[model samples]
Target: MNDKSQLVFCIGHCRIDPTDNSITFQMQGCSPFANETTKVSLQPKFIEVLSYLALRHPNVVTRNELVEQVWEGNVYVGTKALTNAIWHLRQHLLPLAHSGPVIETVRKTGYRLLLEPEYEQLNVLEDNLKIIEAKLDTANRHMQFILLFMSALVVITGVIVGVHLYQDNLRMIDTQIKVITQDPGSERYPRLSHNRRWLVYGASQPSGNKSLFLKDLQGDDLPVRQLTSLNSSELRAVWSADDSKLYFASHYLDTDECAITQLDLATNEIHSLAPCSSEMGAIDISSDGNYLSYISKHESDKNGGIYRLSLNTQNAKAERLSCELTCNYEDRDLAYSPDGKLLAIARRFSNISEDIIIRNLNTGEEHRLTEGLEDIRGLTWAPDGQRIVYATENSGSRNGFIIDIKSAQFRSLDIDGMSYPNSVSDKGELVYHQYRRQFEMAYYSLGGNVPSSLFPLLYSGGGHRNPDYSTQAARLVFVSSDSGYSEIWISDIHGEKLEQLTYLKSRVAYPRWSPDGLKIAFIAPDDSHEGNRIYILDLVNKNIFALASGYHNHGRPTWNWQGTSILASTSDGITEFYLDNKSPKVINALKMGVGFAKSSTEIVFSRYDVKGLWLIDLNYPNRIEPFISDQIFNAGNNWVLTKGGVYFKSKNSTEQILNYWDASTQQVTPILKLPRSSISGFGSLAYEPNSKRLVMTLDGFPQRDIMLLKHKLLQ
Candidate 1:
């Protein structure tokens, strides 16, 4: 083994600089494996283990040897610590691991480096210094003087820039945050009174229902009063001009209708105002208390719009406000200015891109404030109305941002898990909702006479979803946020040998494999349009390319049997995309085209206005027919197509059942009952033909609480 003092090892395509204890690798033509490169820092012990393995390259480094070398022979601690060291080292070498496993584990012995390594023993910097000394002794003094001057200048410039960045970061993170509610249930939609005497928020009850709770902020340890006891959810409670009554949005679980209600503080009575949309908690009151503004969808409209109802007039009807954007845009999360002259709205163009826009109430003019933003959770205006604070999301990371209405300049609060900005008080205090959640993956057997068997596949600190299997490659691709951001990951069909794939630092989903298994196509957000864009990853080059450039918002993408073209869902219908830059062909009849038959030209799809699965043939694209219409399916993407039939999950009033539609008989048959609780909204499905198993993701109950921030910055 070589000495560990000064050696730079190149393991496959990744370069390890032990001098700095950093590993550098290329991800999308950029590096993110070191402290100077990315915020993801590598553990020093993990690097030591890797360095030991490389020194003994191609030879099995026994567990005892690594433990003695890296952990100083602490048998009890080194046993498990060595295992974790190997795992983290592999994660850092993910780019090279995808091609082939960098470290191969010996079954009963130890681990060996599979990738060949090359290292140099000499230090280049020391060699350069000796050469400079020799040149100075030979009277070549001009070159020495020029090099020393340049070195000093570089040091001075680096110091100045470093100090500036340090100061800027300090200013950006100078906010004090405190979690106000720490109960066991989900709490959200916090509203602080204008006088700063009371704070109101929604909390989950023992019956698994949401209710409003009010706390007196003026006194310590005061009894928190229960404001609402409705069986349904009471959310978005706002205060009136005099704080005498609370106006809130309520959704009935039995009827599934959302409406606004006013609660009288004196008599403890509730009055109905107007009907709302399923998107609850998007209601706000005007400053003068003359009108109530909310977001709701008209029956004939595709997306919801901001609507205003006159609260002072009898028999007042809601009218949709004029939006200066396209028809496909969705307007939500609104806040009224303190003087009622402006309305701040979060407009979503697609799943990936959203922005905050200020709408003039008097002139009916709208202007954009923020652009290319991720999921805007909530928006609120400051008490002075000169600045606005909003919450947005990227992957699983949540951020709180404050923007000046006059200058349009903003900065992040740098507080993590700050999900929703509910309200700001006159005392310059901010109240918001903090949330955290995760999902896990599991598999269920579909084979003979065995009882229902659910096997845990993957569970970690973060979430995993959108699982897809490739029979030809014997690998599974899915999206996981275990690395602190949502990225594509791959593992064996048995959920072993996991490797991270993409580092886009954005939200991605719905990965589908090509027929040849050498490429993968997935859907990621594009800020330029109201729909998500399709990206194709070529395993050969390890590069990602967009499917097409257009305004069409692509849905879940599926590959053709030949793998030359991809069929994706659009607003109107399905469109076929080619790899050779051919013009896209649109088919208006089919909404989401998913799987292809093994030996036939038929493709399974669903329609927007229909209740069941439909199919179309490649030879006859116009001839579309219903494949299974016996019962309404839960969601379009909740089922997977295979050669035998279509395995789908259907929910009744009591339980959710997994059913299969046979290709030979064209009949639906019940297989087994599924776990009703904790199932994700559109629990996506994947199947392995050889293994006869189904994969799905399940979510845990979200942990939410109301948080308060105190700072003079907002003031």
Candidate 2:
């Protein structure tokens, strides 16, 4: 055949003759050919060379023709390179072309295939169609059988899944729950060691002093050991991976400073790690013991954020992470993943809302795991690393929830009531705190000298707090969780004609009555902003409106006497918000809880760090001074300004006293000794001047204990 004819008849698809068990190559590596006994693998250039010769088998090809077609007219590739490629191709094809020599080198020309090429073609479309139809019929039957088998497999899988679901339901219904600590005092922040043999927790005595204690889980008869006796409060203890050391945060009462310390179990010695700036005491140590994660405020900015401390370094220095020098949100309750590849943090956007966020340590990429979650108390990583188990307020109650990280799907566990998830074991055992709080509103008559329950018969077993009395309507507006979620509720002086108002299903705090009693102002979580905003409830119209929205949490809202403006406390300080103009002006830049006097021109607030009550006169510049000193209190909410004096709750030793600071004589006198309950520092107190009655919420019954639950249903 001539060169032009040979080029036109170049091999296309690789062919095989099953009768002789022989295969012929097309464009060598262009098509991959494999069989039970033989396989052929070749390079692209070799495939081209073989194709040029295979199409013109048994015929000699000129060297110029072979090089031009195979090498695409590239002169730089010498004939020796072609010779090497041909040698390699022959070796690869020898096993497959078993009957004869695959290629033979011509004396002066290029090459020739020894085997006679069998070129097959369809002369009749009808015969070709019949062959294709027979093969297709066989393939369809095989496909039908495969589909039937797949359907059967789907049925079997569905049945197995249904049975598993039924068993899981039964397991959930019959979960084994045991109370580990049944003490009358509060026991919280339970942490299990890596081996699950020891559990450490913070236990508060009835005297109100909290200390760390260790319990032996394997032997119930073993006595509990007190790990900390520093007189200061110690909380959130975490065990080292080897269980030889424990790290926790200690807060000194005198200086009100918090420090992170590590304890050596063998030596019974404690070492200080770092001093924290904020009171949000959150810390976690990694499994490898190389780093410690905690929340701290920067020295320069004083804004709280998550920090990582390197233990292996000489100085054991800490560096800010997941944020710049100043973070907008307070990142607390940090938890390191089991693999130590990610960090989970509760980002406190405002006082009312905190959301869980996960950060990739290596990539520095952050993903928000929850949105608009109010009051996240604790968080821990699940053992499987695919989900995060956290404690947050759901339906006005603290509950444990498992959220899938990838899908962001969350479901509340069956457990209820003020649950703080402490730790999760590899075996799916959960150690958490079940908190029970019972507080009631009582009215103390200044003249009658008697305190009685505001609602003697109306008991709902929910928190009643932040009461404000209306002078015009002779009614009281307060925050209550009686309707499953915290809402603004109003009732008469005797708690009759009770009406539920403002169903926001979010945490409502510091409800204050307007001067004319036509409106009530409060702070709640804003769904659109995901932060605490000032909201006003129009009593007449029964409408609620957001008056202010921002990143800062606005609390302790008190309206002016004219009802033209509202004063509230924020992280920055006391802010005066005008009603007509919708403008906020910072009156005092000091961080404190604020309460307006009867005239509204003067305000009384409590200093958090200094533990003093200060008065601020808005009408006069630089008119701020200490009204009462040497008082240990929670926040401004614990104090209220009455026409007679400023009524406040002060901690004396272990007991809290309701003291009246006389407005006329400026003398502080104890009015009543509060009942010993687990009232946290930030308890609610309010006084009505018109009735000469003091309406306050005292911790009537508070019980907290560690609980252990074993279940396989969560998976």
Task: Return the TM-score for each candidate structure.
Answer: 0.70, 0.73
Residue lDDT tens for model 1, 4-29: 46467676556677667777763333
> What are the Cα lDDT values of the candidates?
0.75, 0.70
Which one wins on lDDT? 1
Scored by TM-score, the top model is: 2
Compared to the true structure, candidate 2 yields what TM-score? 0.73
lDDT of the structure predicted as candidate 2: 0.70
Ten residues in a row with the worst lDDT in model 2? 1-10
